[model samples]
Target chain A: MKTSDFRFDPSQVRTGYSHSTIFKEDGFGMNYCSSCGVRVLTQVPEGDHLPRQVCPSCHTIHYSNPKILVGAIPVWERKILLCRRAIAPREGYWTMPSGFMENGETLQMGAARETFEESLARVTIEDLMSVINIAAHNQVHILFRAQMDSPEHGVTLESSEVRFFEEAEIPWADLAFRTVTQALTHFVEDRQRGQRTLHLVDLETTRP
Target chain B: MKTSDFRFDPSQVRTGYSHSTIFKEDGFGMNYCSSCGVRVLTQVPEGDHLPRQVCPSCHTIHYSNPKILVGAIPVWERKILLCRRAIAPREGYWTMPSGFMENGETLQMGAARETFEESLARVTIEDLMSVINIAAHNQVHILFRAQMDSPEHGVTLESSEVRFFEEAEIPWADLAFRTVTQALTHFVEDRQRGQRTLHLVDLETTRP
Candidate 1:
């Protein structure tokens, strides 16, 4: 799917469109009122700053905010973990195991869970290495520097393939997201220097 | 107000309540349906794992997630910036100038905005110092280590008082939130050691 397909309404900020990609993929928002069951209206609520889905009858305002994406940069000596997506949107592309954060879980727990679900790897997570802002999607991507607990990890249903790749073996051209690309690039550079610090950057939404 | 009162629902985790304190305070949720103005129910959707506020009439699932709270540990010389509340919830208590992260703004920008709004201080924000999970409140508090661009920032109507305090002068017992207490404590410890690394900590909600 095109990135534009995922972009939300500017006025609404988080879920900008009356109906957006989220509604298509996650079955969340921009439909019958989650409150009163009437179709929700897109309007700026009184005393509010942005355009929100306001229920006309009960005057309830529905809000959506940027979601957190968590992942790990699993490092074992000189290699990094990589997964080939078996899912749509970016099927066949390689990525660091990552997914939407679940409720009640800390970013650390969510990142570790995604690692297990996608690669079946149990990792000892370390410092957060990256905090990438993907404004177009209203999401923040946080990647942690991690180490493997054992010698082996297997691929699950989410990943058609998985392996540890040397810096030279990274599939730069087939990477899944810009945040992923930026993070891997940082890992390579930091490795060469024998040092690393937090890599903070923003991936602006490419709008026409 | 007690921190327990701020904690939202466990099952309804971001609205953070047995019922949302936000709804009670901001009228954000926990109301009759906004669309139909009818009472909403909490139920697990057809394929979802978590319980959501679903409209019985339309079957729309209202989702809520933890909000990002951004602020700064404004350090200058050997002191830090702090604000005394001029408003309720914790009026008269001391805290780092922090607030809910807003839409369309990066975490750094949002934190800076709060600093300016709370203390009238123009600050050059540096590294994110902490990410404390306040699960009970359905919030993740992100505190940054910051510096003042100039010697002074004005106090606004929101702050009954604004000033810098040495580590000794920090009002430990009278502090506003645990996040504030933890951030301040980190600042003091890091200061004494003459070396500071990112202090990644989770201030868990201690429920009775």
Candidate 2:
């Protein structure tokens, strides 16, 4: 496949969002200190380079790091299981089972959990397929190759529809996010080459 | 090397800290909502599995996800560069140049930036050396193999001392964290075997 096949149109993505805007959407805007309920000041702390939301009363420097998006491409009998997202941020667009990695879980565990949560499919996570850095979105997308325990899966709260698709049946234009498209492409290419190489990509999102 | 060789003693590590304590230390404690400056409630929101610090006034559910600690094992002339941390959490103990990943940077970028910040060395990130999941600590440590730009490096504010060490000269017993020890071991083992492989590990920290 050509590299241009994955070049996302800027108009197709969510507009009017920058890195800081995405950070705020992830519940990271610190107008007030969570520790002392005091108003926070945006300033670089001593020995720190970046400006952080620091509290004057309790002296707490609040930090907001990039979030990890763990996911899995669940395979059963050479077919890939996908879900039509029922949530916003591309509601109706098709995507692999994925979500934010929660605390108290490994990457593999998070991938499996998200798969189950979204598609109602239990998967045995096999290998790391792709690690796509969406720096503009303040997120890293980690996708794993997984084997479905059973071919049984149904619709859930997170997914409007769930079904298995052959390689040719994937909807490239209807994929939820750029990271999803990139991961699925990597998975197909690696499988065709009979390789299990980890795909690392720093995705450059087009800004408006 | 045997698997038992990497088993860490709980007594040798930090004491009296659980996953919740570690979460609070990571600046995730939400006694009050940062958005509305009102007291927050710990409850599972609608259709959510885990209990989050939710704002009743703003209806915002505050999530605390696992954090990523990015680092690099800087390689120069077959020697590995390491730093002696001057800050708390294993002060003065030897560690790879690592810190919490910040916003607007890729994993490789964060690794290179942390290497420069702690050891005053510039590195071209090579490959994915190790990804260790410390679930109890709510952290995923991602270490990369990096090639030093030059042979010049000195002590920085984060590192009290910085130097390159041959394989035999590594201070394994004095390593700061279990994740560091595991990553370094993987690095050495892979180098000796003439292999470039991604090391994925779920470190089971011994609880007191």
Candidate 3:
């Protein structure tokens, strides 16, 4: 496939490496600075092959191999909380309270913060649930099981509406994304089975 | 917090309206382009507010939303099929065989394709196991459970290395990412619990 066949251009990101090679064979070690949007290249040994790129402006090393964090699933009586984007793609469609990991936070902390930010609900994270590797996009998605601290949390304007729906009442047609539908299906089925396995991991030094 | 506090700017990828301010209650209908990543300043009618972005280059209407597909916890008696990257980022790290959905391809097809590509395994995706909403960064991560088609689908250098490890033999120190440990934990617990619930959902989409 031609370089253009790929959706994104690494060169557009300008990480010092070939901003032109389409299918990159090395691990992505550099990245565009979030602050300045400048590409950062990583320091590698003369012969050592690393994928991360370092930013010359801010001096931050970008891992071409970025990782995704697993968050939690908070369920209310037969229903779960979801959000609708105040923005696009599926603006006004339904979604769960989710966001990316913030600096200096654990995966669970990121999940809890997002859940509260979007849903206005404070939840106590229960257990480590699942971790998903979406290699197509080069991300790692993580999941956790959490308990609702309050059932009275109101909805944010970020969501069109926030109400618990029975498994059968899920507005499948109106769901925000495909992942939301799939996740709800799994949650409902697991609840019916009444089997929840609580698992935790030592998060001393999660990926930096 | 100042808008600058946010690291990754959606402005680079989104168009039309200011993502930083669109979330304000008073800032309804402000739009962004799904393609050109331009922030358009427009007022959208309330309630009927439809905020969507269209990509300029690839006529692909950008949906900053999550999608789902299946993944496998493919295992032999004591070993599992893990993938090491031959590409960038965490190039030398290990991962599971997981991928996104394709047109007309069932979830199983996506899972199998990922497995074969990453680990070079020929296995039948057994049943719907778990759904993880790895939407933190953008895409969702889904996981499933499967039985290996053959035990001899030996290691291929397509990845750094493909190997099996007993529960006791898991190389905790050298794993690729956080999700690996999370997935492995869930797999082990499920095996011990007789695989009570075969499915899971990563509700809080954005974590890492």
lDDT of each: 0.70, 0.82, 0.51
Worst 10 residues of 2 chain A by lDDT: A1-10
The sequence of per-residue lDDT tens digits that candidate 3 reaches over residues A1-208 is 0001111122222242343331342233213343344644546523323334545766544333334444456677756766667767788787777765532234455677667666777776655554443433444455666677668666676665666666677777887755565455556666788865422111121121
> What TM-score should be assigned to candidate 2?
0.89
Regions of candidate 1 where Cα sits further than 4 Å from its true position: A1-33, A36-61, B1-63, B75-78
Q: Candidate 2 residues B1-208, lDDT tens each? A: 1212121122312232344554443335779999989999877688876667899999878888889999999989999999999999899999999999887777887887788889988877887878888877788999988888788899998899999999999999999988889999899998999987888888897545
In model 3, which runs have C-alpha deviations exceeding 4 angstroms?
A1-208, B1-18, B21-62, B154-158, B198-208
lDDT ranking of the models: 2, 1, 3
The DockQ assigned to candidate 3 is 0.05
Best by lDDT: 2
Supply candidate 2's per-residue lDDT for A175: 99
Query: Where's the lowest-lDDT run of ten residues in candidate 1 chain A?
Result: A1-10
Candidate 1 lDDT over residue span B1-208, tens digit each: 0011111112333232333333332223444454454678766677455566666776555566666788987767767889999888789999998988655556776677778778877676776677776655566788877887666866677898999898878899989888899888777777688855665666677443
Residue-by-residue lDDT tens digits, candidate 2, A1-208: 1211121122312232343554453335779999889999877699876667899999998888889999999999999999999989899999999999877777887887888888888887887779888877789999889888889899999999999999999999999988889999999998898987788888998555
True contacts kept of each: 0.12, 0.58, 0.00
